[model samples]
Every structure is written in C-alpha cells, then in structure tokens.
Target: MDKSHNLERHLMSRKGEHNYSATVIWTGNSGEGTKHYRAFSRDHEITCGSKPTIKGSSDPAFRGDSSRYNPEELLLSSLSACHMLWYLHLCADSGITVSNYSDHAEGRMIETQNGSGHFEKVLLKPVVNIGTSDDKDLAKSLHDKAHSFCFIANSVNFDVRCEPEIVVG
Candidate 1:
C-alpha cells in the first residue's frame, strides 16, 4: 500500500469544521462580593457537555485557592494533550506503535508593569515509548509533525517547542 494514498485519505477525512464549547460559572462570591479587591474568592467551575466539572481558580499568587486548577495550568494541559493526540495519530499512520507516552510541558509568561501578561514560549518534553527499536528516528521526527498539526499549538501566539525522547520498550 502506498503511504501517500493513505495520507491523502486521512487528510480528506478531516475536511470539516470542528466545534467545541465549555461553560465557566464563577463560584467566588465571598459575602461582600467584589466590595473590595480582597473581598472575594477566586473560585469557579468549568463544565462541558457530560464531562465532570473542573474546579478552577486564579493562580495562587493572585489570591486564588492553591487547591484548584488555574487557567495557566489548563492552557498547558490543552497544548500537551493536543500534541499527544496528534502524535499518536501520525504514529499510527507511519506504522509506529506507541506503547506509552508522557509529557512534562512548561511555559514562560512575562507580566508587563501595567499588570498584563502573555506566555512567551512553551516547551513540550514528551517521553514516548515505542514497541520496536527500528523506528526510533521516525518516532522522534513525528513530534515535529504532531506539533504542526496540533490545533491548540497552532492557535497559540508563542512558540511551542517539542523535545521528544523516543525509547524502545
């Protein structure tokens, strides 16, 4: 079977728009509720379809609860997960069997003197375990393709760098 035909078929199958939605309900109303900067909590709930609700808050440095997930963490998670999913798909297309995968992703943000901030870059350190040793190079190269195809990575303004470690197990 020709790989190009398979690639064309795969590309053809993805010709439609994909839509997603989520709801965030603010749970922060401390009695006084925004009466002062310190008067309210920074808690919230995130829900989408039938998925379980996620407890969310601002980063602890901003007076939010340490126990809850912050937006920055969620953004990193989205980028990591999107890249992993695309990598797995491309691996399957390239005849590489991925046995295990994990990523330790990190991002850097810079805050301006006026209180605005933006992520400057994100690093995705993926440890991918493949079923055979013959395709180690191919496995490592797939991370680049995955990063290119990742919707979340493509949507972000900062650089999403991939440093994938391929291991045969």
Candidate 2:
C-alpha cells in the first residue's frame, strides 16, 4: 500500500455522521424572571459534558453584561476554531510541519432599525509558522481546502475568509 492511498483511506474513514449537544443554563434570575423586558438579566452558562462551562450573555448592545462572552463573539470563535482545527489536521496529513499557529479573527454584523441583525462576514488572519522543509505554497493553498471542510464555516450563511501568512523557519 502507498502512502497516498493510506492517507486517502484515513481521510475517508474520518467522514461520517456526527452529533453534538450542549446545555444552556440561564443564571440571570436577579430575583426576577422575565417579568418585563428590562427586568431580567441576560446571563447564562453553556456546558458540554465535562468541559468547562462557558459564561455567556447577550451582546452588550442588547443590555447584556459587557464582561461576559456574547453570542456574536462565540459565533466568530466557532468559525475561527473550526478553520484552525481543519487547517492543522490538513497540514499534519500533508507533512507541513507547523510549529505554531495563531489567528486574529474578526467578524462584522449589521443591525437593522427593527432590532434585527445578521453577520456580514468573518475574516481569519492566521499567522502560521512551519518547518523549514515545508512548502510555503502548499501551506497557503491548504487554507481554501480547510475553509471548505470546516463544519462551522459550511453551516454559516455569511462569508468566512481566511488570509493566512505562512512563515517557514
């Protein structure tokens, strides 16, 4: 069996149905339940199995706590994380030898006059450091494939663009 054939088989084996679940517990009672729109807090906690609970709140623009993680930020984070994970896996399979990877991701949302809004896009700026033997062009080209395979990016309606800077050390 050839290396390419083994890699193809491994990749194919990774494809299948997956199920995810999360529990969101609202923690913002403040002694009053949604008696009025302005009467309750918008704080909550998101837990998934044994992982650390993520403290979440509505965007500060919606009268939520500015110190907590907001849904919008989480959405952007999901996209960025999904892309980075896929990129790293693809790099490993392609022998890119990544030493370090970091992303400064940003997202844009446009709110309408009626208090409705939608994400316009997300830009992922990944600074990747690879081994000296790795092909920089190949590393750069892998981002497009990574974006295509990213579960979060595929599920989103807005654009998720990856502008990666590959540095060979």
Candidate 3:
C-alpha cells in the first residue's frame, strides 16, 4: 500500500458542522460558586463544576468553582481534547490501540496595540503511550496519519505535535 494514497484519502474526507448549547446560573455565597456551567449535547447534559482549587473546600459549592479551569484553559483543553479524539479514532481505524493519551497544551496571548491576539498558535505536545502488542513502526505511522486527519488541527494554524512513547505492559 502506498503511504501517500492514505494521506490523500484522509485529506479528501468530508467535514461537517457541529453545534452545542450550554447555560450557567450563579448562586450566592455557599449555595453555588461562580463556576457553574451546564452543557447539553446529544442526549447528555453535563453540569460542570470546578475543582476545589478555585472554591475553598469550606464552601458548600467548593466543587463547582470555576477557579480550576478558566476560559483560557477551555481554549487549550478543547484543542487538546479534539486532537486526541481525532487521533484516537484514526488510530483505531488503522488497527492501532492506544493505551494512554495525555497532552500538555499551552498558548501565549500577545497583547498587541490592536487589542489582544487570540491564542495565535498553541503547542499541543501529546505523549501517546501504546500497548506492547502494538508494533513500533505501525504506531509511528498511525500517529503521523492521525496528525493529518485531525480536523481541528488542520483548521487552526496552531502547531500541534505529538511526542509518543511506547510502554509494553
């Protein structure tokens, strides 16, 4: 099988639009913290609550504080999450099983004269740990294949890179 053909085929795949809805209500002092959000999508309603890092454990809604993950985090985290999901799907289709997938995503917001330059580019350093049954060469191929197949990655000018490691367990 020619490698370039695989890339071309992946590139030619169609892209579709996605939509989501959410709402959050703020409650006073001890009732609920300022970090509350409701996300609704495809038969799932996620009532997100932040970790105690933001709201002190002494508070009643300590777990629902938005201090743990801010808006900036959402930006980077979503990018990392989207990339990982696409990569995982590509790997599975390519007959590769991923044992673990974690990413260290970071971005810089340049305060320019115009205002603020949105996260111009983010560095998504993903460390993919694969199982022993997976072949190293094949795993590398799948990782490369996934990088090309990820829609969010291609959509953004951000540089996303994966530094994968294998651990046979």
**RMSD in Å for all candidates:** 1.2, 1.6, 8.6
lDDT (Cα, 0-100) at 102 in candidate 2:
95
Task: Give the per-residue lDDT of model 2 (tens digit) for 1-169.
Answer: 7544676799798889989999999999877799889989999999999999999999988989999999999999999899999999888878889999999999999998998999999999999999998999999999998998899999989888989999999
Question: TM-score per candidate, in order?
Answer: 0.95, 0.93, 0.58
Please report how far candidate 1 places residue 57 from its true position, in Å: 0.3
Please provide the root mean square deviation of candidate 2 (C-alpha atoms, Å): 1.6
- Model 3 CA lDDT for position 56: 16
TM-score of 2: 0.93
Give the clashing pairs for model 3.
none
Q: Which ten residues in a row have the lowest lDDT in candidate 3?
A: 51-60
TM-score, cand. 3: 0.58
Per-residue lDDT for 1-169 in model 3, tens only? 7645675577578556667544443333343433453321112123444422221111122233443344555667777788788777766666667888778877765656875555666777777777777776776666666677666677766566666554544
Number of clashing pairs per prediction, in order: 0, 0, 0
Can you list the residue pairs that collide in candidate 2? Answer: none
